[model samples]
Target: MAGGLLGTDVVTQIGIIVRDIEKTSQAFADFFGVEKPKWFLTDTIDKTQATYRGEPCYGRAKLAFFKLGNLDIELIEPDEHPSTWREFLDQHGEGVHHIAFVIQGMQEKITLLAGRDMPLVQKGEYTGGRYAYIDTVPQLKVAIELLEND
Candidate 1:
């Protein structure tokens, strides 16, 4: 198989979809013997953009991140919206939703994946970075999220 446009194999984060961010984050912290992860509401995300099945849609999630070694363990609680997270939870239940990789030249990478028939599912910007989720479940059995941090 060919390598991705990012030209790397390292996973930056493993995102898990949940029904409740607070409960799930607490449980993860307890199981891992770490402090409770901080939560961020999707409504606070800036420059957010997303599409579902090629149509514009609105979705929100409450998210928490716990750094584990070189990668983060991300928990996402889908809000009342039609988003990829919500769709995943509805179709597959609570589980691993996507694996993330940090990359440079995000637009070029997105174009490359889109050329390969992997459409962008969702995207948003945060404090110092932005992220895009690509729909790759049919071929890879999981979505791929690309991150570009400033």
Candidate 2:
């Protein structure tokens, strides 16, 4: 972890929480002159095994992605459930939620970040991967998401 926690500082995705994914996604697509990527809802709690603050979380969000260069711009519209996305939107309004990096050794990375004072906030599973959100705003001014593809 010399260069960075996961051995790389390269960010693969920037996640933004929005109150209106349909409008925001359309705006982004129009601004970039790219076709609007189809928005999809995340898997349910049972399927995703999502947790928030150490508790089972039923929250989910509508997601859309814009691939730009090496980074993916993600738009998230969170449901009313208690999720990091929903909490961020409630407290800070629509804005960047997290910067994600694809990495291996998810558990080790989480432990290392927690030792450095950035603890885990929320985590969940996607179709092909798992993700953990680290509470790094105090030090980095933004959250860090670790995505582990299996």
Candidate 3:
């Protein structure tokens, strides 16, 4: 997977953390002249506890998925919990949090990144794909990930 990292697609989505999901979605729609995105609220979705830097972290997030020519511009609003986007929200106040790149083999890529000591910040799968993140640049307050077809 490491050897083939450069063989996959480019970073397709630039995720932004927004305060008002609907307003933000509308703004992006107006700016891009497109339809409103598909919104998914995750505040009651994943209940599993995850480890972040050896500490327990719990949370949920709501997302708006905007499809744009084979790419999705995602707007995320994090629910109350110490999620990865918590700091990004407090510091930047609703802006880009991460860039998602689509790949072919997610677990294989996860193993490759883990071997490099870049453990997953969190991982999950949805209808379109499976995704896993790495906090390689934690200070940047953003995550880089591997998204592949499920």
The CA lDDT at 11 in model 1 is 96
**Model 3 Cα lDDT, one tens digit per residue, 1-150:** 453552465778878888888899999999998888768865333543444444565666778998888777888888777767676697779777778887876777777777876677776555666666676665445677667775
lDDT of 2 by residue, 83-133 (tens): 999999999999999999999989998999999999999998999989999
- Cα deviation of 38, candidate 1, in Å: 2.6
Ranking under TM-score, best-scoring first?
Answer: 2, 1, 3
Residue pairs with backbone atoms closer than 3 Å in model 2 (clashes) = none
Error of 3 at 53 (Å): 5.1
**Candidates ranked, most accurate by lDDT first:** 2, 1, 3
RMSD, one per candidate, in order: 2.2, 0.9, 3.3
Q: In candidate 3, how many Å is residue 132 off?
A: 1.1
Q: Estimate each model's TM-score.
A: 0.88, 0.97, 0.76
Tens digits of lDDT, candidate 1, 1-150: 234467778998999999988899999999999999789877543346455556665777888999999999999999877888998999999999999998888888889899998888777776688888998888899999999999
TM-score of the candidate numbered 2?
A: 0.97
